[model samples]
Target: MAVLGLLAGCSGGVEGSPVAAERWDPCSITPEQIAATGLDPEYRDEGWGKGIEIPDWGRCVFHAPGGTAYPYGLDVTSSEKFTIADARGRDGNLSVRELQVGGRDAHMYKTETGKSVRDCSIALEVSTGVVVFTVVYHTVDGVDSCQVVLRHVNDLESAIPAGPK
Candidate 1:
């Protein structure tokens, strides 16, 4: 599946790459946004896309003190490929709901109920593709990844460069 995503992602060519977006800054998320997640927002991975075809659409994993690297990530890209179905009911998700973001069509979903959460994602409709915000956690951390998204989704939206609505 990973291989399929890589090749399929190339359909947009270089013009649709996240790095090509002028106002889209993946790291624009403020400290307050990370703090809302109750995780250590201080620790962050700085490298951009090292392998993904969508240049800047790399993963951002935030770590908590004494915690393993969670799969949580924030990706802002112009590649019009992924759909909300891709982010729903997967990755241990339990419930999914629509979101209201600056008049843009958006969706938010949470992982299945358990001792800890697997991850949560928000798919925001963009002019081209989607902006997926993900929060990953360990199996036993008892975390709610959606809480982070709900608290800071606005910040995520603001980072996107102005383009077709």
Candidate 2:
């Protein structure tokens, strides 16, 4: 995937790729807002950054730029009702396909760069006016692209306002 290219470039170990360091800033994210949720958070300064917010439509979403290595994402909502969609992705020299996992009706998709190790998953759980989404991804080496996203979905979900009656 393009992310692999970016990731490869980040480590500066790959030949013929221009190596560069990556940095990220949160867009549309508020520390005060995140603090209000009361869920302990683990923040990491991965390259390309992340953003968390309650969109104008009243759904909470977290997004990351695909410009960096292992670019993937998740979006969740509780505006009309509790719902979630978690996604992981790579966007280079690879094919795109969708798969359904475990018959729970939740879906997962992968966008890769080449015929190499790329992986991702997304899930939702809701109860007691709370919605939780779990998203995960790893390379063939089992190294994560973004561990923060996996550890913080529950905290992010708790920040969403209750769904309608």
Candidate 3:
């Protein structure tokens, strides 16, 4: 098995307002790199939060600074069927849906109460079988979800595959 690298958090996309970039220094590794390490980076989003009370389903992954915080941390697994939207804290009100992202299968779940603005997207890397899913949610005068999602995706892409760029 591959040595599991350090884990980190990423942001999704937002609808209305703009968002800023984020920078962090960790033992960065992509889904593909994880496989190279002899570990198959499975699941939908490795960094999924659990039992967090999110107002909207999309916002679950897309978190803002000082906004409604998620108590759970990232959950990683080797299951191909991963969930991007889950309302573990509240009732089963939250649900997830699947889609084709980056030429691969992906999922996007949201609550009915979520406005159209509350949407999520994902990209998958077939080479390393890495999935980059982003969820956009509304915040109370906070950063946009889109920004976070974009940054997370970018970071993962950069860290994976030590090959010709």
Winner by lDDT: 1
User: Considering every candidate listed, which one attains the maximal TM-score?
Assistant: 1
Better of 1 and 3 by TM-score: 1
List residue ranges in candidate 3 displaced over 4 A. Answer: 1-64, 67-113, 128-130, 140-144, 160-165
Pitting candidate 2 against candidate 3, the one with the higher TM-score is: 3
Cα lDDT for residue 9, candidate 3: 33
In candidate 1, what are the lDDT values of residues 16-69, reduced to their tens digit? 546543323455656666666554677676445465454534445555445455
Judged by whole-model lDDT over C-alpha atoms, candidate 1 comes out at 0.58
lDDT, residue 93, model 3: 29
Model 2 regions more than 4 Å off: 1-61, 64-66, 82-150, 162-165
- Model 2 — which ten-residue stretch has the worst lDDT? 20-29
RMSD each, Å: 11.7, 20.7, 19.2
Compared with the true structure, the alpha-carbon lDDT of candidate 3 equals 0.35
Report the poorest 10 consecutive residues by lDDT, candidate 3: 71-80
Q: Which residue pairs overlap in candidate 3's backbone?
A: 2-37, 2-38, 11-148, 11-149, 12-145, 12-149, 13-145, 13-146, 14-145, 14-146
Each model's TM-score, in the order given? 0.53, 0.28, 0.31
